[model samples]
Each structure stands twice: as structure tokens, then as C-alpha cells.
Target: MTDIKVDHIIETDVLVVGGGGAAARAALSAAQAGANVRMAIKAKWLTGGSTATAFSELLAIAAAIGHADERDHPEIHYEDTLDAGRGFIDPELVWTLASEVPHRIQDLIDIGLNFDKQENGKLVQGMSDFATYPRTCRVNGVTARHILVALGKQIKKRGVPIDENMMVFKLITDNDQNISGALGMNMETKEITLYKTPSVILACGGAQHIYKHAVGTSDMIGNGYAMAYELGIPLVNMEFIQIGPAAIKPSMTLLSGPVWKTKPILTNSNGENILEKYVPENVSIDEVYTEKVFPFTISSAAYYLDTSIQKELELNPTPNGGVWGIMPPGSEEIVQEKIPKTNGVLKAKGIDVFNDPFEVALVAQCMNGGALIESPDGTTKVAGLFIAGETAGGLRGPDRPGGNSLAEGQVFGHRTGQAAAKHAERSTNSANPEGKSHAALEDLADWIGRSKGKQELNDAIVSLKENMYKNCLVIRNEERLNDAMTYIQELEYSLENGEFNIDQENFSAAIDFKHMLTIAKSIVLSAQTRTESRSCHYREDYPEKDDANWIKSIFVTQQNGEMSVDTRQWPHHRKSEKSEVKL
Candidate 1:
């Protein structure tokens, strides 16, 4: 541990790291629980994260509100969620979320989140992806955006201190393994700031953009994942990431639901339907397009569509690294009404989705794995350290249930914030002990020191992304995965050994490159260890799910600078909280 002078010291009861919907909701919950909370964000306040820019009405938040149908309830939602996860989810956590999300949605409504309402004064809910009923509630196409707006207003009204442009670098722990505080750097001022808090909530989202082609926000690198790994927190299902065919040309928006509803024929540049050629004879193009609207699950045949599209891109080069998606006639009216956002975005790019063969490709959509947390409370193995949102794993399993991510942010965000605040109130150690922040400071210093004359860092990032897309995305096998592991290990070695000059001006990019590479290593390592195809983690070598051997979730943790991959079977036969409702 190196001795470094501190620039600024901030004392709070709770420190929420991130600026997305989860972070905001956590802050609000903490404040309501009568704790002083401070939120640190790397970007501009209330912008640039996944929650701010997510699209698709199908990306709706699931809460069994029973609006569309009276039979819809939490128990049914729980079963749907469990089925969507393929029975590998944390039963208690999934239960808590499925039971509590409707209440959280009501909380959002109280804070001015206006869902589309019906004429009879009920919230207009719709069915999407994996649900058996219309339980998803949304406001047009931008559900998460509006939820963020509502939560932001609440945080502002409660007078929570939000420090923008402050990139949190490390989580500080005390001698007893308790979270003492956190450290961050001011991006604009270039000054280090120490946050002395008893509780820290990590809502730092996912690291999906490690692949070259991804439908993630620009800053959606896995800093939280790296921090968790560095601090020895075990991650679950690290190999399971949702992948799907998305719009590439007119913007990287998801080309599901609306686009698929138009009966769009996915073809090559030569106007050849390739799904029939590559997918199993049992799967059909119409069924894949209609049934697999958004979520990319291996259980569903829709994944074949994504694989076929990717193969088309690789086999036949199209404009802008995308394939042709030709919609049938009368698509113009459907585009204007159902997919106004798609129409407007494509219209600006001089491509009419209704009349033209828009470019689309298989892209990295969401990560279903992250740092594992205890059920109902969102606490990690480390005391006073909690995780919420996409940063926390185990709530999801091999595949994702549509809209659960947003609901999770609200549900666990509220629970984690309340839990952290209560813990902070009971704790006495509010100050950072001597040398507690030293290791974190050393890393920050290392990042600063090595960031000089390092233009190759950008090249390394590009290479990492390209290699991940080539070896890890959509299709995976033993040979390609091994090659990826070798390349990544070499890059990690180079970064540690200072083999290349890093750009000082682009500190964020350098950090992003490291974090992305770290998560990519975790994904590849977990993927290699799990020798069976299940959910989103498909191995061509092991083409079928092996329940006898591979039914357990893979856990990846770091020990003595080396990765240790392990697995644990789902406990308690996947019993949910709402077990009263019979299927």
C-alpha cells in the first residue's frame, strides 16, 4: 500500500456509485430512511447510462399489476421469471423481485412516473418476450428514461448531493473486512476525492460493450465487475450474456418487436433467406421472428435467427457490417404508428425501414451475470457493501426475463438502499483507517502514471473488442475460446508490465479498456469452464444442456492474482416467495 495525499474528503452515511435509475432510486430510498446520501457519477448528471438511452416498448418493466388481466399476479410473474431464467436464478432474490416489483412500480407512480393509461383509468400494460400475460407496463417506448426522470425528481426534491463528473475508482475496506468508504477522481479537476461512508451501494450497470458490436451505452464498461473481482467478490453466471440481432445502420437500436412484427424478411445482399440454410430443420423463420421478439434465449428458436444473421454478415459482406432486413409491403403505416422512434431515427439517416432493406446484425444486448449478492437485502460477502442493478448477478440466471432488469433496479435499489442506510446507522466506523485507501490510491496513481504517451491503449481496446466479437459472441467453441483466452491474458500481462504507452488525455478510455478486458476475461473463463450449452451460453462443442453435470451456475473469483472458477447447484428446488399461487 502506497502513501498518497488525499485531495478532498467527503463524509456521508451512504455512498451510491453510479448515475442511472438504480443509483438514483437507492439514493432516494436511503434519504427516505433518514440517512445522508451522496451519489457519484462519471458522466453528466442523469445521462449517458443504459437507463437513460434504452429503447423498445418491449423493454418494459414487469410487475404483476393485473391491469390488463385480473388473473395476473405476483405468483404467475414469479413462475414466468423462473422459467425465463431456465431455473437457475436465486429463488429468494427472484421471489423478492417478483413479489415486490408491483409495489415499486406504485412508488414510481407516486413520484410522477406516468405509464400509458387506459380509458377506464387503468395502466395500459402489454405482453412482451417471455411473459404468459400482459404484465409489462411502459410509457410509449421510453420506460426506463421516464422512470429515471421520476427518480431524479425525487432525489432532487429530497436534496441528495449528486457529484457529477466524478469517476469512482475504488471501494475502500477496513481491517475487519467492512466497507469503510470509497475513492473517486474528478474528471475535469483531476483531483482525488475520498468518500468516508459506512455503506456503499454499487449500481454501476453492465459491461456489454466489450464486444466490438454491442447495443450498449458508450460508457457501459464493467468497472463495477473489475472492482468486485479486485476485492474478491465472487461473480455468478459470468458467461451468460444476451445476444440478438439489432439495428446497425440507422443507429444500434434493437430491431425486435416492431421490426419483427412487420414480417420483415431477413435476407443476404443477394436476397437469399439464410435461416432455412443454417438453422435446424425443426425451426422456421416465421416462428423465430414472431416468438423471439426481443429476449435472446437458447431455449427459444429465435436465437437461430441471430446466429443466421451473423453468419450472413460473415459470409456475405453488406454495407456497414450489417445484413439486409427487407420488410413486406404496408410496413410504412406500421412504422409510423407502432415504431415511431425507429421511423424517426432511420428517416434522419436517409433509410426508410418501410421501403428499404435496412442493415441489421447480431449485437451484444445485455449481460445476465454479475457480482453475487444476498437475497432480499442485496448485500455482498463484504459487510456494508451492497450491489444493485445490472452490476449484481444471481438475480438472473442463464437467460433474462424481459423487463426484469428495470424492475430489479427499482426493487433491489429500494431494498439495498434501505438496508445500507440501516447498516450505516448502526455502524460506528465512518472514517477511513490508515492505509485503507492506500491500495486504491496506488491503482489510481498507476493509471495516471502509465497513461502517458500511450496511444496504443486505444488499439488494444479495439483489438480486445474485435477478438471478443470473433471468438465469444453468438457462436463459441473450444478452439476459438482458447484463442480468446490467450489473447486476453497477453493483453493483461502487457497492461500490468507497462508494455505499451497509454494516452494520458484519455484516462477514461484507458480505464474502460482495462475494465472491459477484465470482464471479457471473466466471460471467456466461465464460458470455457461450463461445458454445456444452456440459455445464452452456447458452446458448439457441447451443443446440448447437460443437467447432470452443468446444471449449476459458474462462479468466478480472483485469489492471489489468479482466477478460480467454481460452480454451485441451485438451492431449495427453486422455490419462490409467491409459492401460494399454484401454476
Candidate 2:
């Protein structure tokens, strides 16, 4: 058998992986800093990630919104974020992001990206949350993607070497745990790419796809997070997950979650106004509903608020693809005709989103925290590696406040890229960071050439996704989680031990599934550790938030085949003493 050789060795001051907002920022920042960088994202050139489809970004344009009296400075934004995080976030990171985000976003605009504007030409902020002011800013209602498109064009113009359809098999390193380089496979040729570089930034989104019915795409299998764990990085707050704002995807045309106007009458199928049941504090219509329901809803049905009283005209938040889509912006006729699929889903499930009372589950959208931040410079505990964006934890600790994700990506992504570039500039090496032995190197060489034939990678990938969707979705218990985990593990094991084929279509996909399996286990294991109910770490056995002992982040690590977890209490934010945090 012929062995596949390293196609080519490329050296760079930095390597930024993934195409989401974080990676875009990383690539642009590093290149602007005069570092040679290579960018890679899984899957092909189209729809690479959820951020690709993310119509909103909460960070880049907050203070520039249309609301004339909006008091949105980074400081106020920081506090609101801290409060939303439940204080589990590392104050340093939160403070850093909050302080610089407004400026950072403005910088993005200055760099050729344009945010959507109102009739008066002010930057438009969508109905976003997490601050005393409106924060989610968009360009024609698509924030990150717009930024992504711009960055892609700019990066291309600069010619800073990027590989499309490149699957990151794993991070390659030497004995010192310094990230030397990475090994990837090209989707077109089914070839192995073992490129060595000094520093790397991992911005590969989150592993939300590990769960069934995820708001994210199947590509968000947490490869970066899983690879970090495999290579000895401490992942933090893996227990905190975030379901979305609505029971259905915003992309859904017909059936949609209620609009803000319907809050006064929001109810579940059981005829309960969720806001009243949870807050009991007679709040106004504009308060974040997640903040009200998250504490208890995790252990119970997600959201079943009563909205029976709202007039038909004022309730709708639906959209069709592209622009000019109505968000339940009109009357019931729009929903009935345009997005009847979702409407039918609601009606079939006996949900009356229109009536005084209706129930809808805010499906698990994404994970908020994971892979503890060990670097003040955004470095993981791993020497040669860095983590940014959603996969890297320590942004918001307790619970992620709404509208802060895009900011963290931009701010920390900038930091991670710069720091990594500096590290690359200082270092000079061409060996694996983990000191791969001769035998290990030989094994890698052997595995590179070992595939035989008749492998259906897509089938396995589909099965894994379907299983995840079915078993690990909105609600779960030990029995179901365990079953799903086992099934996933078996599939991973089969791939590892099988002798079917090489370079076959399913080949790289199988590799992807392997990574997905690791990520899936991380989710299940992390979920199993936090016995106390809080936020998305809901437990059927225990249905109440026990801040007494469970406020800490659940940390997980895996070695060989065993997984262990350690918990750390949520950081204490002394709200009484206005101890200042400044830009």
C-alpha cells in the first residue's frame, strides 16, 4: 500500500481555524498585525456555520442603535452581561469584552462592513436583550454573516492563504504540549494535510449539534472543544447551555414564537402565564423572558406562557429567507400562508401560540460555556494552542446573557489572534508539540494509508445526527443520555477499529463523526455532573435552582476512555460595592 505524504508544509506566524465571526476576526487581526496566517473551516464553501446563518450579532453595533435615548455604553453593557452570566464569568474577560466591544464593532464598520440603518440612517438594533439598552445590531437583519462576507472578501484581496473544505482531523503537537501545527484532510482529494505552525487559534463554534433538535447545524459538533479536551485542555462550565428565544427557528416562515407585544398575555398549554408564574414581580413587557424562565424552566417544560388576550395584529416574529421577511410583523394571514409548516407543527402539537395561553419549548440553541480559559492572553492551558469564541469558556460564567456572543467572539478573537501571532513570531520549530515518538509517527503514517473500500461516511454521519436529534434534545434523564452516549461511543469505536476503506467519500466524514462523538460525550458527561438544577443544567430529579452548592461551573476532562469532572463556584460579583471595571 502507498502511504499518503504531507502534501506541503506551510509555515506561518499564526493559524486561525474556522470561518465563524471569531475566525474572521482572528485572520484579519493576525494578518493586519503582519503575521502570515492560514484559515480553515469544516465542510465546503457554502453555509459553513450557524454564524453563516446568524441574522443577528449583539456586539458590533450596540451603542449606535436608532433609539435616541439608548444609554448603551460598554460599561453598562458589561454589568448587564455580568448579571446575566450569574457572575460565573471571569470578570477579567467580561470586562475586557464589554469595554472594547463598542469600539471593536465600530472598527469592523470602518473596515468596510455596513450595518443596517433605520429610515433616519442610524444603525438599526433589532429587538435584542442583555443590557439596559438595545444591543443587537444588524445589517439588513444579518449581523455576523454580513461581517463574514466582508471579511472573506478582504481576506481574499489580501491573499492570506485560506483552505476551504478542509476538515481538521486533530491538532498536531510535540512533547511539550506546545501546539506545533495541525493535521487536516482536504474534502475534494481525500488527502491528508499535516501543516506545522507555531501558534493556533480555535474558533470552531460550539458543540450544540451533540444534542437533538439543536438550533445550530450538524457541523457544530464542537470539534475545537473536543480536540482541546483530547489534547489536555481544561474545559469549564460545560453545563451551561442556552436554548433560543423562540420555540421555532426564526427562519421558519409560518408558525413563530410570539412577539414582544404578546408578553402580557403569554401562556402555556396549561393556561399559565409563564412570566407571572416565574417572576411574580409584575414586570413590564420588555424584560428578557429567558431571565425569568431559565432558572425553573430547565427542570420543567421550557415555556408555556399565556398570550390569549393579545390582539391578533400585534403578535408575530416570523421570517422567510433573505430580506423583506415579516417577523409575525403582520396579521395571522401571513403566518397561515407563508409559514404554515411551523404553524401546522404548532397546531398539530396542540399548541395555541395565538390564544391567551399556549406552550412552546425554547429549544436548546447552543452551549454557553466550555473549555476553561487558562490564558490571560486567551491561551488555553495548552502552550501552542488558543481558544476563542463559544468553545472557549470564561466569558460569562454563571449564565450567558442574551446578545453578548458576537462581542466575545470579536473582542477575544482579536486578542487570541494577536497573542498567538506573537507566540508564533517568537517560536521556531517543525516538530509535533506533544513530542510524537517514532512509533506514533509511523502509526499516523500508516493510518493515513489504511482505508480499504466500501465505507459510507455520510450514512454514519446522518445516523449520528438523527440519533442526537432524537435522544439528546429538549428533555433528558440518565437513562436516555446514557443510551445516546453509548450509541455514539459505539459508532466512534467502529470507525476507530474498522478496516473498511480509505479515501472513500465517508472517510473524512467518519473522521468528523469521531470528533463529534468526543464532543457529544463531553456534553453528556458535563450534563451528568451538575446534580443541582440551574439554568440549562436541568435535572428531573431536582427541579429547583440550588444556588447554595450548584452555582459553580462544572469542569470536565477525558483521558484514554475515562471522564472526570470538577466543579468551581460561580464568581462572586459584589454588586453593593460599585468596584469599578473600566476600558
TM-score leader: 1
Worst 10 residues of 2 by lDDT: 317-326
lDDT of each candidate versus the true structure = 0.81, 0.62
lDDT of 1 by residue, 282-316 (tens): 76767876666665556777778777876787788
Those runs of model 2 whose alpha carbons end farther than 4 Å from true positions after fitting are 56-70, 117-122, 244-302, 305-330, 333-364, 430-460, 499-505, 574-583
Off by over 4 Å in 1: 1-5, 269-272, 276-283, 333-341, 430-434, 443-455, 572-583
TM-score versus the correct structure, for each prediction = 0.93, 0.77
Superposition error at 146 for model 1 (Å)? 0.6
Which predicted model would earn the best lDDT?
1
